[model samples]
Target: MMMLRKFKIVLPLFFVASLFISSQTNANTDPNPKDKVLLTILKYVLTQGHYHPQTIDDTFSENVYNSFLERLDPSKRYFLQSDIDEFSNYKMQIDDQINNEDLSFFFLVYERLTQRIEESKPYYKQILENQFDFNNDDIFDVDYEKSSYAKNTSEITNIWHKQLKFTTLSRLNDKIIAEEDKKKEDETYQTKSFNELEKEAREAVIINMDESFERIEELTYSDWFSIFINSISEEFDPHTTYFDPVVKKRFDISMAGKLEGIGARLQKKNDYTKVSELISGGPAWKQGELEVGDYITKVAQGDGEPIDIVGMRLDDAIEYIKGKKGTEVRLTLKKMDGTTKVISIIRDVVELEETFVKSSVVKKDGRTFGVINLPKFYIDFDEKNFRSSSTDMAQEIERLKNENVEGLVIDLRNNGGGSLKTAIEISGLFIEKGPIVQVKYRDKNPDVKKDTDPKIQWDKPLVVLVNELSASASEIFAAAMQDYGRAVIIGGRQTYGKGTVQSVLDLNRYHNLKEDIGALKMTIQKFYRINGGSTQLEGVHSDIMLPDRYTYMNIGERDLENPLKFDKVPKATYKLWDNYENFNQAIDNSKKRIATNNYFKLIDQNAKWLKNSQDDTLIYLNYEAYKKDLEVHENESLKYKSLRDYTSNLTYTSPLYEQPLLEKDEDLAEKREAWHKNLKKDMYVEEALNVLSELKIKPQYHLVKN
Candidate 1:
């Protein structure tokens, strides 16, 4: 079966190459011959090469059908129930059509969607022209998943009317409040009447919708086809995706960790572009104004007038936000606290240094310990001599050893993983010689990846700090340490369950075609812990769990669609390290401390509040009611403000070796200073230090001094 699986994957490459060459020479005059070629190759690779390919049967077809519609019209504002009924005919036949390389279903949906989009332009324009009755008590359900498609034109029109009204009402309230605040500051200040403010709000909505529609009109057929292809590709797993040429370039830039932009990652949430993460040492991060969860509503270049981006596509919004180095980009954000703030940042090349491993020495209760923050398990595939996480980590640990640190805390929080080879090498640094992780390709025997070198770099007590975002390579290192009793894992419930390994296959490489066919990033293998457990949907459980804001939220691999199931392989033969005299005692001591801690109690409460906020999706259209709701939420949020302000008494400082480097680079010094300040405010780091203090090393296991 293993040989057959290998043969199946290899045979297609040769077959496709010959077929592609022949097809190109005698190419049909189809508008997008590349589309058919791409579709055929993508399907072949996924089905043959995927670690756990889904049977492309009726069930898979139905999944692709539903997923495509949702991706195209998540809010159900475009396609009506009648259109869905028409498209339902191919719901079960998609499998057969895909096998036949027929794009009839995609073409039908794409054409219908384009038509609906063009026709629906007048819905928002017409609705916004008239004044909204804010006095009437109307509610709009923001949870589109629970809502059904509109039955007819009137139903869809009503849906658009309520959505526009809800948006306009919020803006009107903000305008009115701003005017009142201005009058309060200066008694001579002229305040606009309620009617005039309302009109301005409606005009803003019209401009936003018009711009959004225009952007949508600009999308090529190829753009829609990418969405269609992805809907099918993602059915196998969330990580497996088909990247078009444009998307592939962006992916490569992200991997390189060098780009000219605001250095903030944005994701499209409904009609808004939300700030997902602010890259450390980037312009936005240095500015200290933008934050995760804030919705960007408008963007302006330098001193130019702010252009509304409320309804713009994610890509389009990103283009407006990113610019050449030394340019200023201004963003108006709708803050999480129901307030708006405009922040300006001078864009610069996002420094990649922050993403690499950095260590800080801190003294707590007269004991010195080292804290190493590894953002990701990075490696440069093209340049083998380039710096990697494993090499950098070993060097950092050696530097800490020179400082005579008693214990170490490896911070893997928010690390979304990178090179698999680096993860094994890093794990090998702590252990003498043993299997670090077990990897299994489809239908093949588990391959035990071991540390052939018998040298133990750090024999001292080690504690790994992780969160829900720590994934893939992060999980591998943490899991290996946990299995071997080499380190105490601390932080969230578990790491992100991303055990699958993916390899990006350049589709254009299969044939000598000039056309850009793009690439496919597909899963090829799964990694397992040495103890036999697979970190597919159930990640490595931390020895000491910490209360975080994402505790009650639905996150991690299980929350994703079509995730691989958890399974176990035969445990690798290895001896556990018995170096610690009080490993269990340290965990118990930490747990007891956390139970009595007020900060943790407040964090738990805040997590519940956040989950409740996520679940409550209804929006009041009436101005007074909406204002009251916002005020209530704002007041409630005040109780948890101390969680942000809570700081530990411990002081963090740069190692003696880094002082000279810091003196030479002002930006580096500033970044390190900021990081140290943040460490002082980190309760988790304080707890890790406390645990490290309790972790007494056995006398026999102590390392001899040079």
Candidate 2:
């Protein structure tokens, strides 16, 4: 892997990892007995992260793997399954320093290359000077084993890393000196001595480099794929992505309550970077200058030549985008068609404190109801001005109380979670203080996170709105509220099962091995509800699943590969409240209404049709029949196209929605069926909202289970 110079952040899952926020509480990292028991229980439940080879062409004939290895080693003719699967035996304990071809042939090849490099150390410079070619078809006529270079290539390759490190020291020093000189030139009056700054920068770069390499070599393909996918995803749009746990953690950390640059979600499609989803009220959304589907072609400083960002890795791209807040950056964009435009986005220090600074009200359900839309359950790092999600939620309740709202809805849908502290605090908003969540560790006892405050923020009838996107901290708050019988969990069947907690291991911070290279993020903990239940693969179950068309869509944690499974710990001591007696009646009434509702019925029928549709893998050739079938289905799939502006923003908006099922007019029913099948799911979201309305005003039972 090629190393580059850069700054760092506890990336991926910022909040969960607790990377940079200085005000974060000293996490409850102490060892305990219950944690050990839970760890034992979790050995099987926690990690479904197996790298199952999907293609049986486990043989090298699969062009993808072939191209993959070729990129890594130019002379690598081919690798066998024996080379790949040999490591199946070493499922958990993977080591690179040790030669273990017994692990797999992939290891064999890797070791082989390492051996080759080490055997010919002095000649390591040859690689940098020349390209490593496996398919010499592009360059030489020599036999595969025969290279133009000296035969002792193994020694050279093995020692290349360390030797190059030593050799590059002078180059690093020179660069440091140059940077120091530049800093002095830019200095107004006060400046650090060149020697002092140079020393710090040099140490930072070298140590970061070493730490980064160690982490990179040990990363599994599954982990590597997220970074790779991220690199690819940016070209499409910013929101859609595939983040393995590690990267996901980094994301949390990078955006923790606006700790980084202007808060905005980003995705990569290809060499081109596209903006997708923007945080509704964050810097980007507030600016209202950027839009989803707007492709970011280049990112520059307040004033600088637009850098051609094509083909750059996603991480590098993000590093470029993030810097000291309050700075100004210019982004050159490409519109949907091909129109080019440039816009300036000012970098603002994300004022995460805004998350808990206040709350609002929404009048509904024949009564004024308080609305607390918490996108993330965040906590401020400072104790003096500690703005926690729970604390803020409490304040919102006070305002709502003053407004005299009869009911309240805590919207946790699409919430990916943040502070555990906030989750407990928020849950306490509706109940008498008690344990809200149980946290288990790998080698210690599980601890009950309790709300010690004597006062309840709001005791009025409460409802928690959740969807597949609600997870982790979201789950904890919702689950606690539900377990306490203080609120109704309404919306989807369950939330996203991102229940694990991770800690950041600044491989560089603590070790200072590599300088410009970033740090390693590791999964080190798991969370559980105080009642022994966990929000893992099975997120918090809703009291009532709503009727919505999007209920048909595939999204959230359960859809993820190798997600952690669900299991429960022992129940905790707590008081449960029961007030709504018409819960089931309300659910039944809603279901009956939805059964006859037009939008609900059409979506239901569409979903059923899609369930049995073999349209995805079929073919038809009749032209007349094909055109008819394609025409009808295309319109049906987009049954609400005229009603809903669901443009993908890929091509320009069509003047009419009467586009063909098959753009080329090839298949008849097959293509039509495919379109309908994929289009049917989103109807569920509508169904969900309907379910909520059904149970909105049923008779209440005030007695409690406690």
Candidate 3:
């Protein structure tokens, strides 16, 4: 569950532990062999070809080092002066080449960023200064009050920099940057230059700034708070984190995607809670006349005239949409391509069945196998953590068995994992009693989660589907299954590879100041496979590689600031399942053949185009060129068929809701309330089903001849 801490847990930087855990670990105490061994292995794995960054000067300040140490020790549980001393051996010497002038350049850039952030303050002031016009129908059209967050970060950093009583910011950045680069080099990795990277980063920031700002308004007080806390962690290190109260609620919702509402997804598009996507089987989707991309213009309650919601905050809009499931509501919508309509539907308890164990039959190449598409390794957030995706999956396996299905394909495409407990529980359904995954914290003892339950759920021939978005818990389940030789992994190169565990911290508690601000989401520990490999940056590998745009090393936890390093520890004491080796070899052979196929080449070309399109700097041009290029590329990317995946099914090419109204509903008054319930939670269970059902071809159909 997304838990937001009500209070921050602040403390003096360190507590002397009685462990001298690793050569690089700081706790001053007798080390446990398991912990020490793990530390040594991780230190070698993460630090071997990399360098750590710091910004210390002649003053030999320890604060920068302290901050770095504090980040690794999210709980501040294991690090001590002794650990700091251990790291000192590898600390870089800040030569003149990398001194103030160089550092100041970056600081200057940061300053400009801050100035822009400050520019937003006045905008925020305008919002707060303007009184809500209750009499006017435009209350929902109120714009966001801007705030000075980026500027604040700059201010905080500058203030801290001046207080540098000890370190230089550049020195600090260089150290980490050097370390990362060295690691990359050691691995023979490919990356862009700093100049190019900066350009790319700038464009991305510019594009996302408005989007992220808008998101703040749409987010629940808790969701917004959780993200705020998470971003705070980014300031310290990609891993150190904190949380406020509301976020924890969101984490709970993620496991099940359950919420109190009409079961449709809403977005604050230009000025309203836009119906971006309608949840299948939900009240709205069942209405038959409803279309995707419908922009909701107004909403009304019992006996109340419909209130215009053009510019309302997404969170506020949500409050309007959620009520007792049996309640009735009406919506006046504008379609995207230009159409309008009034639809009335009743709300009811909407269950996300697709997030549960969904099964289908894949009949291809004269072979029939039962397919269970697990979009995510979800767990129930409700009291008692009563239900989980794995538990439900086991039940589905039983149902598939009833259908006399042969083999199984577990689809995890775009499935970012939800619950670790569920990942292990679900993996248990495949393998015999053994360690499911091996977890190692910075200074704590290694924690080995197990699937020791002797009873296996379904050990039939199986395959796991993974893609760029399959991360965290998804990697765990897939990896464990592959390790046990229970299933073959299929899809992208690996996964998103976020094998770290994060816990929310209330920074306000620790500081006892500004408790009203958001909290932090800190990375406390890193997870590993029973085989001893960390899932940090390199997610699980697939037995069968598919042509996908995300196959490149473009995203995930590794790309963030203050990220925990990837490494490995001792392998857990677990038995290796047989026959899997042979399965992998066969898969390898299949992949080799597909890699050289002509069709695959076209797919790869499209993948590259998609990737390039995401890079903003690539499209820059001076005035004339900008306009010309924009025209030429207007819909070049759209011509690609894959985008259709995101386009909701509709009869018109234009966005459904923004269109002009053809005719007003004659029964509007009668069904108005009933229709409102149909317009809320918008997820894609039905679409996912369509994907599965359509995929039910025989093995012969899987191969496409040239």
Instruction: Report every candidate's CA lDDT.
Output: 0.85, 0.49, 0.50
| Top-lDDT candidate index | 1
- Higher-scoring candidate on TM-score, 1 or 3: 1
Task: Give the higher-lDDT candidate: 1 or 2.
Answer: 1
lDDT for 603 (candidate 1): 89
Question: Which runs of model 2 end up more than 4 angstroms from their true locations?
Answer: 1-313, 316-354, 357-360, 364-366, 508-518, 547-554, 559-561, 600-638, 641-706
Candidate 2's displacement at residue 40, Å, is 24
- The 10-residue segment of model 3 with minimum total lDDT is 138-147
State the lDDT of candidate 2 residue by residue for 1-706, as single tens digits: 0001121223234322332222123124322222222222122112211111112122212332333333333332223334445434433332221112122433354565444434433343343343222222221121222322222335325334332332233223334545667767887544455445434434543443343344435545544333422222221112223344556566666545445565666655433465644553466654656765566756778875445343334555666677677888787665432334668878775544334433333333354544456777766576686567666667667766776767666667667677776777777766767888887654556778888886766655666788776778889888888787666677766777666764432332322212222332334456788778777777788876754333554445555433456777788888775555555665576567656766655545554444333123221222234234445555566654432443221111111111343355554334334433333333333333334344433233333322
Query: lDDT, candidate 2, residue 161?
Result: 34
Give, for candidate 1, the lowest lDDT window spanning 10 residues: 1-10
Clashes of each: 0, 95, 90
281-378: candidate 1 lDDT, tens digit per residue: 57886687887667898788998756777556678889889989999999988765554678999999877676789999999888899999998787
Per-candidate TM equals 0.92, 0.52, 0.51
Better candidate by lDDT, 1 or 3 = 1
lDDT of 3 at 167: 14
